[model samples]
Target: MPGLDYFSFAEMWSPLFLVFMLLIATLYAFVVGPWRQRFGGVEAVPVVRQLAFYGAMLLLYLVHGGPLSLLGHLMFTFHMTDMAISYIIVPPLLLYGIPGWLWKWAFGRAFWKPFRLFANPLFGLFAFNLLFSFYHMPDVHDWVMTHYVIHGFFYALLLVVALLNWWHVMCPVPEWSRVTSLRKLGYIFANGLLLTPACVLIIFAPEPLFAVYNDPQVWVQAMGYCVSGDPARLLEQFEGPAFFNLMSGREDQQLGGIVMKLLQEFVNIWALYSVFMQWYRKEKSQEDDPAFDHAASGRLNNV
Candidate 1:
């Protein structure tokens, strides 16, 4: 039977092709317009910084939003490798690539008042984690797969959470600009730690948390993508039906749990690198400073 095919999963790659073109165009615009205007007046940032931020964004987009997303859609696992990395990992890096002025021009003006109100640290920490937790709830996850609007909304909400969580770490408000290199590093690690529970739950689960993982109808419904032809093909390759039959629900759960743990490990490594490098540069700066004395040395030592 040709399944509902509502999402046209096979064609998932099509939109990304268009998006890739648009992304290139946007990158060009940023480079030629805002990036140029912003930096033209000031000393250019080091090539290394630019490369690290830009290269990271470009690479992340390629791996997550671009081809990898399409591949995940086609493959149908929705496993931890893509979900954690795409949702939890990539947004911060992408935001880091945007020039400060561009961030100010874009989100800092019209939305500033409302955004500031909503993005308080307390709100940010709760709202993001709360929304994230709820979105992955089985019913909500299923709903997103079934309807385009819900799916888009979920993605948008995820973006908002990502932006909020990253605000203090990457593009902090002026009032809160006192974040030193050590502080930023700590922030990243904190986030990595915060994500551990979710990762562990998914990775060590006795069974799949989401019902869609086991049932084809529910899975396809939740995926909102139609499958066709051989039910066997869909069962064998895409839905992990073979594994589902062979393993206890507890075993399935544990698989997801493990995958989440691995995902956190990746995030931990990346975040550690980001924080350490930031602090390292600050250390280098202090070392080069003539004002450095015993007290300053003590402070550095404390850091």
Candidate 2:
């Protein structure tokens, strides 16, 4: 296999993006630490939450601007791995990491009230899954990959909806959470169900569905988004995406689908376990409450 070392420095590490991400981390530290009082933060953010936030940023940099981003362009499987990490894993971590006070400060305004409709669990659930499925449609995927501006805008939009979708599952602000614990489990299941069809289509296709992976001309055009030079030169230098791919196009596509499905299932199972444990703990606490014990004794005596 051709190593990523063959790629240019900018292509592999994306120094500018790394700097931008570092700046974001620095700003988060200031806002949550020094500027907490100014931002209406009454208490310090938890250490665990801060770590989660930093971890999410690291994952974001890895998939979006790191070597994985370059590899994604070369192979369908890597692309799907990026997608799973970006949308499935990263959003919840980000939501968990930020302080509730920060979230409230950012979105508590009257101006945001109207837009809060977009945060509805049902709206987020359906909109994100639908848009995600639509994006994977062979023609749509090819088109988005080739158009730089559209590609950027659409992916940003997707990330926004992904955050919205996960907000229900891991709403940072407890008081502001709309979905109940039981309902959240249902929501997670529905998300898994909704995403299955897109994975199924990709996995079961008899041949490669995406022209960007199979056709050298189309691959070069799509490579324009990541590679700095004239994309046509990619054809001259490396032959095509196949030059980088270790597997046949069909095998790569199938593996990509399986990877996506498995990652989604793993995340969902973890979510289910987390929610169930939370519910169990809450129930146990209620059962052990002194008030509850008195009330139960009274009821038994009356009976």
TM-score (all chains, Cα) for each model: 0.70, 0.94
Give the TM-score comparing model 2 with the true structure, all chains together: 0.94
Compared with the true structure, all predictions reach lDDT values of: 0.57, 0.91
lDDT of 1 by residue, 99-148 (tens): 56555556656647766667565566567767776766666765665686
Q: What are the per-residue Cα lDDT tens digits for candidate 2 across 230-254?
A: 8798777677889988899999999
Number of the predicted model whose TM-score against the real structure is largest:
2
Which RMSD values do the candidates have, in order?
5.6, 3.8
By summed lDDT, the worst window of 10 consecutive residues in model 1 runs over 1-10
Whole-structure CA lDDT of model 1: 0.57
Kindly report the root-mean-square deviation of model 2 from the true structure over all alpha carbons. 3.8
